[model samples]
Target: MNSGAPSSGLDTEGLYRVSGNKADQENIQLLFDKDHTVDFRSLGISVHSVTGALKSFFTALPEPLIPYEQQKSLADAVGIENEKDMITALQDVVKKLPQIHYDVFKFIITHLHRVYQHNQNNKMTSENLSICFWPTLMKPNFTDMASITATLVSRTPIQPFILHCPTIFRSRLEPNSFLQPAEGKLIDIEAEPGNL
Candidate 1:
């Protein structure tokens, strides 16, 4: 295997030497370090609301009746006029919560494009660079994944690369299985296309 110091144009100090051959994992560690200046944006909901929602869902008594006042407030929050409308609204909120979180995460990640570009101009030493991304198991939004991939692919110094995605079971499986070109062909492929 080839090994050398990453090009001076890349933020070698920021890049952590991850154990596995996965770029996504390494990138995550690099970006999330406490000292890293990068900022993250999450869903706007308050911590109190999130905690309250969880508590209300898990701790409610069996066959419990919804307190009239609490039910009315929930209805108002969701823009519902009656009990049945409230149930539908609540269900919709529950269903959309995960999606909202993902959108927020994607927004934060997309903002990293500026950092990546800055690194490319100042620290890039190699003719080729690699980036890895792993789809979260909770809810995979193809649009967000595609957006992140597209942003990276559009950058310069095209080179041979690998994107390793672990199975939900954590099995190694096939390295080529989750890999694909960052742009061009719309279809998702198992590995980098020959052009890359």
Candidate 2:
């Protein structure tokens, strides 16, 4: 998807913000289900369709990329005072993800970081991408009504999480990876009342 996005979707105004044609997304999903090797550009698949399928794949997972028990840990790690400690804490939590989850998380975050790097064209900074992704990445463990309400009211601050990702996953990132250093000044979610 990242490979195709540069030529086809990265320059689009809203890469992941807009929905793709349902038929295109379904077709892509069907190909994926059949385990066929897909070349989105060759198939003339819309970038939005590819993105939609990517997100749908995550949402359909039996367990979210961030496991149920660890969601709060990730959120708490983001709330730590010191930036280095925060990165360490996040890394610790991420290290515990099942191997497949870790790999997929790394790939998805790297892809999103690439999309963010092209924000001038796509208009999707880490924050906007987080808004589109957090629910699927960090799902609630409970199914009961009370827990659901609590989960809704106190969701993870995925924007800050994404912003700190470069440091958090430094060891796992590739040398030429788009997961370059995050913004020079990390947003203090608590300090920034406007962000809250």
Candidate 3:
């Protein structure tokens, strides 16, 4: 929202609203076009490479895949880190997310992963990219799912590809249980747990 660029339209019902003049808006809109951006291969559906604001915008949809209204609950859900709880919460939110939103999440994450491998050249990590794209990535609640993604990446070492997977972000407690912080007890043995 801080881009200061006028919003060309609003993304509602899991849609992307590209901001700018009509032409720029139209050009960015091609992202939704199956012919221009979508790709499906052995692994799964993929987004042909594209970069900059368009990619950022795709990742920064106004209505988060988690939904604007659910921010508070997400804190608890993401905190618990129980795979089943996380998965259940995510499944609930994802069901409410429009199909278009799902596609965009998939598309942006795919592109970001490819970008990460070469991030050294670009000097952008998942955390940095998420910040730069903050304007587009934020939700109405003034928070971003990317922030969570960055936290996950920083707390432990994981493949860049894993960072881009919506499922991982949605159901965060994977790869050595990073999603759920350490819980309970602080006897001599428990002095300072990592997740605490």
Candidate 4:
């Protein structure tokens, strides 16, 4: 009674872990693309669907420290005393999320700051920035949701941004086998009869 393709012997629970391994190899390709101070300490982790494609990925930085040139502007916007306090505030939020993988959490916070800066400079846009984190769990145990909520709410006045968690699912449906005929799609009925 098996009407579908044979199972590939892959465990669904282990799909994410395996996909993450492959993502690591792919990330190495980024190094060849451009030259920058590659922070090898920061690793990328991604989940894959049962179909063997990437679902989501995460990247992390050491910590959130505003550069000296931009510290004054960011401080003024957040109404903080100094850049050190700003860094501490960001750290506090990250500290609350002990259960979240370090890479993912850092990626989220880092992009939040980036968006905040972009808005301040009047460069906000709908296009997503190259962010490095993906939220996977529905209810993260390490960090309180209220903290994330508060941070997002506070930043709303600055610019639009998205926080996503990775998830992978299996689909049994297959794509269409053949392209549809396109002969009759165009409507040239209005053309002059002389053209014939």
Cα lDDT, model 2, residue 36? 56
Candidate 3, 1-196: lDDT as tens digits: 0111111111111112222244433444464453443221211111111123354554555555534444344344445556666556644544554566644544444444434444555454665554444334334332556445434433321222224344545443234332233464111111111210
lDDT tens readout by residue for model 1, 55-168: 232233342122222323322433434645544544443233344342332222222232244454434222222221211111122345432343333332111111111111
- Residue 80, candidate 4: alpha-carbon lDDT: 45
RMSD (CA, Å), each prediction: 21.5, 8.7, 16.4, 20.3
Which numbered prediction scores highest in TM-score against the true structure? 2
User: Residue 153's C-alpha lDDT in candidate 2?
Assistant: 47
lDDT of each: 0.27, 0.67, 0.37, 0.29
Q: Show the lowest summed lDDT stretch of 10 residues, model 4.
A: 164-173
The TM-scores, one per candidate, come to 0.20, 0.77, 0.40, 0.23
Give the runs in model 4 whose Cα sits over 4 Å from its true position: 1-81, 99-101, 108-153, 157-196
What order do candidates take by TM-score, descending? Answer: 2, 3, 4, 1
TM-score of 1: 0.20
Clashes of each: 7, 0, 0, 3
- Candidates sorted by lDDT, descending order? 2, 3, 4, 1
Best candidate according to lDDT? 2
lDDT of 2 by residue, 96-194 (tens): 888888877876776676567679988998878987888777655577443354365445456655676667778776554445443653221111111
Off by more than 4 A, model 2: 1-4, 141-156, 173-196
